[model samples]
Structure formats: structure tokens, C-alpha cells
Target: MSAQITLNARNLSRRLGRREVIRNISLQLKRGEVLGLLGPNGAGKSTTMQLLSGVLIPHAGQIEICGINLAQEPGRAKACIGYLPEHPPLYRDMRVDDFLLYAAKLHGVARSGLAEALAIAKSRCGLEDTGRKIIGTLSKGYQQRVGIAQAIIHNPDVVILDEPTVGLDPSQIRDIRALIRELGNAHSVILSTHLLGEVENICDRVEIMQRGQLIYGDTSVRMQSLGHQAGFIVTLQSPPEPAELYKVPGVVNVEALSATRFKILHSIDANTAEALLSLSAQQGWQAQQLTPLQGNLEDAFVHITQKQPNQHDQT
Candidate 1:
């Protein structure tokens, strides 16, 4: 693989006992990019995360982390990865500093560099003042920070986080997201989430999985733009009946908001918009305003996934 690619997987597939939970998933994470693994619950997102983090082996396909083949050189490849699972692994009884120290050593940090590594991890996660305190005594937000600190203590080339902010309050979610954005400034990040907001706020690119298969992949901006293809909204000074509006070509549904305003839904064709403009001008329905609706992520997600075959036998 190229040096700029921190992670590269080719045709990865894995089965749990008798059922195939992941199928032919290939993805890449470039240096300094944040990638989102987006899907609904039970869509095999977490399983894919586990496979990418080297916690579970793929039955078919090659994984290269920092150019080292995971199957041939696991130690070197795993050393280049830092992963935070959906559930944060913590020994609540241990003090914050003690837990992180153990984590750094476990990741193979040398004795001479352990102190520096610990300091940097603590600082990055904003845990400088919580070191002396017991981990269990800290709030959920701080505990999550501790979890992140452990992952990045060794400064891995790629960071993988699964549902990192599943249960935090709004403020805590904001803080964690900010920390994640800061991490993306330097490290390649893969975040698995069912939450659309997390994908919108943190991801540069997105790959959507459903029914053990990848359904869509693209830049976040383009994925979001899919929802806008439905139609536009308009306001007229003298509105016509719903039946009259429906008579226009390509117009599918017209939802009246007020006497003069309506939301328009139509087929994916520019002719629909042109017909509306021409009709409005001819009828002297003084077109007061016409605006496109902001795209809906859920709509785009559903639209992309609706065609997949039903294969819910495995999760």
C-alpha cells in the first residue's frame, strides 16, 4: 500500500459460527482523515469495527496496517492501531494515572518513554487534574476521556472508535466530539455509529453498511445532498387548489402549509422544476419565494439501503 494510507483492507469477510456476519467489506483510511462506518443497529457495524481493530480475524481477505500485513505480522500491525470499543474497558477501582500507566506499558511503550506517553495522553484527554482521583469516582464524561487516553497513549497511526458517545448528555457529547475532531487533525480515525449526527459532525467520508453488506460510500457532503433531490418548496401570492398543482408534469405530491405556501415533492428530474416555474409565470401566481429543502440524512440513508435483500439471520 502507499505510505499515505494508514489502513487498507481488501475483500474482508467473516462468519460467526454458521452465519456470515460480515461480507466482502473493503475500506481505506488515509492519514489525517476521519472515516465513519454508518448503519442502523444490528447492521454489523460493531463486528466490522472488531475486525478492523485486529480483535477478530477475517476469514477471507488481507489487512494492512501501516503497510504491515496483520495476518503475517500481527504484533507490528496491532501496535499501529488504537481502538475504543462501544463499551469502555476500565478498572474502576484503579486511580486514573495508574490505569493509563498500565495501558501505555501494555501497548509496548518503553520504560524510558512511559512517563512522557502518560503525560501526553492525559493532557490530550484533558485529564491533567484527574490523575490522582480514582477512575470510578470520575463522571461519565471524564471516564470516557480516560478510555480515549488509553487508546492514544502509544500514538498509534490509526484510531478506531465504536459508538464513542452513545450515552453522554448534550454537553458531554459536545466535549467528546471536540476531542475527536482534535484527534483527527493528526491521526487517521474510523468511527462506527448509528447516530446520523455523529456522522455529519465528525466524518470526512462515510461508508454505510446494512444486512452484512456495504450499501453506500461517499463524501459526507455528497451523501447529505441526496435528500435534496426529492423536490423544492414554494410560496405563491394566489395559490391554486392541490389538484391543479398536481396536474403539472413530474409533480408527485403537494402539501399545503398555508393559503399560499406548499411543500412540493416530485420525481428526480429538472423538468419538474422547470414546469413549476413556467406554470407559475403563466398563471400569475406571483411566485413569492421558492427554496430547496435542507437534505435529511435519514432519508438519504433509507433511500440508499431500501434495495438490499432481507438477510437478517446474522448480526
Candidate 2:
């Protein structure tokens, strides 16, 4: 992909009362990409979305959408972006189609194009099946779909969704996730949610925030760039000195799960089975099996979030 970025924020900060909710945050999302905004509750996920959507002006910083400065050209910037908050803002008594028509008109959809815009939005979001249903009678998933439809009714270039899959059933969640994937193929998207699996599944990049500060922001591939740390699960035929195993070269740590079972940790990868066999033959050690443990994104998430750190005082 080109270096051209669609959304950029510099040193963004937002204050709620005396407390700063978002602190010196900066990130970028490219055209036709999906970025997951992940953080713990109160970690500024919602606050950051408001800043991006122009719902709340930042106390400090600059935001640009598709080369338009949001602060300098609010109208033009907002016209190119769509936002759906956690809760769908809907007239409960209005029919789905009627509500979409109202939303289209409010978005400056031309009178001549309202019908086309409404139909497109509904079809894109799978709301066509529920077009005549009253908003109040619709299920939570359908309501959320309506919210997304309204957001995209204007056909903005960028779409921001806050907790789009919250409270959804398994099928509904799958549907929404598929829809988000489809949307990301066409428009730049920012998805703010606590769902790590959803992020891992769909986001090209992710930004993790903690205590109002951005602790990590990186592409999925870049996040997995941590140097290899190897692990082996060993089943012993007989027990050896666990303490002595730690003294072996390349063996960083050893955790004994049982008198006959242990795990080996190393910062380097080598012929683990060869080492085990040689040691067993030399020391009369009984080694039945050894297997490598593959690493994955959950490992990266834990490492980045410091959820359960293996070491202390890491920067």
C-alpha cells in the first residue's frame, strides 16, 4: 500500500472535568483499512471516537480526515465521515424505511436521491428485510444495523463504529462482523470495542490504550515482530535436577509441572529433541517426548498489555 494516510491525529487530548481522558494520542488509518481501537473500560476508547467524529472537540491536538483538517474545516471533514455511537439513536415508533428516509434527508441527501440512498443503505446493512418493522419492535441486532445504515446513508469515505457488536447473539455477531469486513473493503473504518477476538479477526491494525494513554499502536504483522522465544513441553521417563536444567546453555528458565514433567523456556531456538536425547543418554535421564509451543497474537496482546508479564520493569 502507498504511504498516503486517510485519517491522522496528532497529540490528541480530551478532558472530562478535571481529568484528562485521552492523553497525547496519535494514530493513522489508511484508505479501505480497518483499525481496531481497544482498551479497558474508561481507557478512552469512547472519548477517542468522539474526538474523531467531531462530537467532542479536543482540548489539544489536530485531526485530519482525507486531507481535510477537522478543526479548520469541520463541515467538510464531517461530511466525509460517518459515526455510529454505542447506542443507536432511533425514533422507536418510526418504520425502518421511514427512519432511514429521515436520516438520509438529514445527511443532505438530495430529494431526488433520497429513495436511492435509503434503498442502498438498507440493502448494504441487511435492513431491507426489516424495512417495514417498527424500530421499537426490532431486535437489538436489527437496531444496531439500522444505526449503521443511518451512519452510512450519506456514503461517507470513513466510518466510525463504537461497540457495534455489543449485546449481539452469536449469529448476529457473525453477521455484523462479516458486514464490517465487507465495509472495510470499500471504506476506511475505525472500530472501537473491547472485543479482542473481533480485532484479531478483522483489524489490519490495532491501538491499545491504558489510563488515557496510547500504550501500543501497530499493524497486526508489526505487532507479531517480537523476537522468537521458544518453549518446549517435555514428558520425562525419569526425573533430573530441575535446577541443573536451568544451568544448561540456551535454557533461560525451567518450570517443573510434576516430578516427571517440565517445561523449558529459551530465548533461542535449537535442536531441542537432540539436546534432550543427548542429555538423557549421558545422564541416564528419561525423556519420553518434547514438543514446541507455537506463538500467536494472544501472546502479543498479553505481552503488549503486560497482562501477566514474564519480566519486570520493561519499557
Candidate 3:
């Protein structure tokens, strides 16, 4: 069975002041999937999040939330989305319980259901015991938890988080990451951040934006494949000339790093280790170490964003 699509955007474009900030970006989010929006500063990641959450109207585009058209029925469409901006909307003077109760009401939760909604939000955000505490008295990490609590208070079908871990310490970042992973189990999540490592750790799929446009969008599996296909590092007791190693089947190119170390570039279908071992025995080049060189998300990000627009789209 196909997964249910909770959020969809097509031809989304936006102009801030005199310059166009986002151009013709299209994306989809399915139920239970965590989609990461990655880019450098001024890449329009924040603007895209605002558009998707109905916080900013697009100059030209269509947004649907849980099948409701945002332009035609903004109230219904926004009802299905929970948004936490870079600086979360929180009332520092109010108690955690009071703030969440207000947020629940603002989202249209009936008076009768407010208690249940508040409980659920607090429990999910690890704020259950701190309900009576003032928002200002909470630590930065707890404050972030409160921010997330308010967003999910209404139990929306989709959640959009912008730079959720910014200004956080190492421990706080780990805690928040765990919460984000937990949120993905029940709702479609859109995470926007300039941090590439976060995307590598938490996202199932990633879309890279560059100079106001989406340059690449693919599953994490496909992104990792880019790195794995780069090549392998092989060490031998007796290093042969680069040409000798290139003679092996499936070997594309060889660069000698030292008398005993060489970098071997090979086809994706090549069993590089097995071929190297077989050839080494025959040539008296005792193999010492043969390891696949893994590629990282940073490499893929650089490769996509550094290219010109006319070069590629949606790889």
C-alpha cells in the first residue's frame, strides 16, 4: 500500500521585498516520514518552512495540509499543521500548563478537551512534571521542550520545526533529537536547518536548497550511495605500478599514494576486494588492507549546491 501524503507543495515561490527568495520549489511529506530541509545561510530554508506552515503566503504556489487547500481554506489547512519557528512563540511569564492550555484553545480545541490535550502535549514533550513552573524559570533545554509542547498541543497531522536545536548545548541537542525522532513515529515531520550532520542523523530523506531553489531531493539511501561509489583504499606489501592494478577487471583507475598504499577507483558493480585479492596472489603483491571509503552527507551537499542551476535538478 502507498503511504498517505500529509503535506504537499507545488510550484512554491516567494518574493521578499525587491528580490525573489524562493522559486518554484515542489515537495511532499508522507505520514511517519522525517524530511530534512538542508542548505547554507540565505538558502531560503526558513522561508520555505514559513510557506509550508501557512505563516507566510507564497507569491505563487499551492499548499495542501492533510488534503485541505491552504489558499481556499486556510483555517482548515492550518488546523492540520503545527509550527515552531527558529525563536519559538512562548509566554515567559505564564506557567507551562497555562501556556499550553492557551495554545490548545488557540488551535480550536474545545474547552472539554483542553485537559486531555494539555496532558498529552506535556507528556510527549517531557514537561508533565513542570506544568506549575513558570516558562522563564525553565532551563534552555526545558524551554525548548515547552516550545515543542505548544506546537503539538493540538495534535496536528504535520509538524514543522525550524532550527530546533540552535543555541543548545551538547546534552540538550541530544535530548531534543530524541524527541524529534519520537515525534516522527506519529506525525509527518519537516525539519529545516543549516546543520548537515543533524540531517544525516535524523532524516529519512533530504532536500537540498541552493540560492532560493531546490537542487536535489532524494532518500537517505540514495544520498549515501553517492559516497559509497567514490572508491576504495587498498594497501599491499609490494605495491605494483598503477597500470598493473588498472588491468584488473572492473578497476577503472588507480592512484598510488605510497609504495604500499594506493587508491582504487572502480565501477559500482565491481567486487573490488575480491578482485584485488585474486590479482595480488597471482602478482605476488601481498594485500595488507583493503577497505571501502565511505562518503558522507557533507560531500553530497557540497557536490549539489556548488553547481550552477542549469547543471542539474532533483537528483
Candidate 1 lDDT over residue span 63-165, tens digit each: 9998999899999899999999888999999999999999988889999999999999999999999999999998888988899998999999999998899
In order of appearance, the predictions have TM-scores of: 0.90, 0.83, 0.89
lDDT of 2 by residue, 1-315 (tens): 584577999999988899988899998888889999887788899889989999999999999999999999998898888899988889999999999999877767889999899889989899878998999999898999999999999888889999999999999999999999999988899999887778878899988887788888888666655423577888887777787787566787789888888888876655555676687778877778787766656667767777523332454
Scored by Cα lDDT, where does model 3 land?
A: 0.88
Off by over 4 Å in 2: 1-3, 224-229, 234-249, 252-263, 269-291, 296-299, 307-315
Expressed as tens digits, the lDDT of each residue in 1-315 for candidate 3 is 888999999999999888999999999999999999988998899999999998899999999998999999999888888999989888999999999999988888889999999999988888879999999999888998899988888999999999999989998898888889889989999999888889888999999888889988898768866646557888898877777888888888888888888888888877877878988999899898887888888777776676645475544
RMSD of each: 2.9, 3.9, 2.8
**Candidate 2, residue 100: lDDT:** 90
When sorted by lDDT, best at the front, the candidate numbers are 1, 3, 2
lDDT per model, in order? 0.89, 0.85, 0.88
Best by lDDT: 1
Q: Top TM-score: which candidate number? A: 1
